[model samples]
Target: MINEVTRALVAHLHSRTPDLGSWVVVHSLSAADAAPAKDKLALCLLAVDEHDHLRNSPPVEVAGRLQRAPMQLRLSYLVTYFGPHDEAMARLTRVIAVFHTTPVLGQDELPLTLGEQVERVTVRLRNTTADERNQVWSVLGRPGRLALFYTVDVAPVRLLPGLDGDGRVLAHRIDLAGTP
Candidate 1:
């Protein structure tokens, strides 16, 4: 589900800025370690944090059956521009500008899987402390490089199908006469 969102963003970026079509790449942080080519930029999904807004929500009704609500997830990504120091920074700047303009992605912009279930997704810049940023690179066993942190929120990832049960109110008795 999350992969689709990432791919959609990459596609959108490519469409908006045709120049970056071949230069932009999306992959996981671990994957990036395997291929450290300095020519292409990468958007790495570093982590995912689940949101608590609907964490405890009860099962929702779907087609008259009770189905579990999908957990909302916040995807963290590290956008790294690779190449000469100045050139990399320049590409990074362009990446930031693109995100700044399109902070939110509507359903039409998402993949069919996400578009059908999620209403919208939000992309925001995450400011990380030096220590925190260093920790991420350390975990990957790679030296720190120029990168920007971003968080993408995806809601209701419904993985389970609706359970078979009767949820409809068959009848209701009125006690307007002050009787229990």
Candidate 2:
């Protein structure tokens, strides 16, 4: 579900910014050592936290079984550009514009892989200080790169059920160190 949110963001960006082409990627700034040095944009999921207010939401009913409530996640991302500084900054402007216009993404706008529980996700540009950004860089053990912090809030995470459609328990595998 987390990755699906990222993919949805990337897909939305690509759909909105045609000139960006296929350069947008899900990457870590620290892993660019061996990658090609072409002009591209990188989206790094810096942190994922549960939405505090909705953490204890009610359970769900699916196929006559009571399932635990969906876990709502807030996904934080850092968008970075690698290559020519000037053009990269211009692209950042476009990104900001896109998000500014459509901060809320409906289920229809997102990837089809999203579960039934996720109705929508909110995107917000977080106001971050240089010190906070630097702390993130410090935690990554890498130098700070130019980045914008965006958070996608309320992405629902629904766990799969143990029983199959036919009311049978799914297979399980347990590996133990010692013989039974």
Please, what is the TM-score per model? 0.81, 0.79
Model 2 misplaced regions, further than 4 Å: 31-36, 60-66, 115-117, 163-180
Residue 21 shift from truth in candidate 1, angstroms? 2.9
lDDT of each: 0.79, 0.80
Model 2 — which ten-residue stretch has the worst lDDT?
Answer: 161-170
In the range 1-180, model 1's lDDT, one tens digit per residue, is: 778888877877777688765777875657345755667888888877787676777767778665566678888889887788898898888878888999888898887877997878888988999999899888877778889999888876775544443255568998777767
Q: Which digits, one per residue and each the tens of the lDDT, describe model 2 over residues 1-180?
A: 777888888988999998768878888666434443468888888889999898887766777766667688999999978777897788788889999999999988877766355888899999999899999888766767777899889667777668432232357889879977
Pairs that clash in candidate 2: none
State the local distance difference test value for candidate 2. Answer: 0.80
Clashes of each: 0, 0
Question: lDDT score, residue 138, model 1?
Answer: 88
User: Best candidate, TM-score-wise?
Assistant: 1
Q: Report the lDDT of model 1 for residue 160.
A: 52
The candidate that wins on lDDT is: 2
- Deviation in Å, model 2, residue 49 alpha carbon: 1.3
Candidate 1 weakest lDDT stretch, 10 residues: 160-169
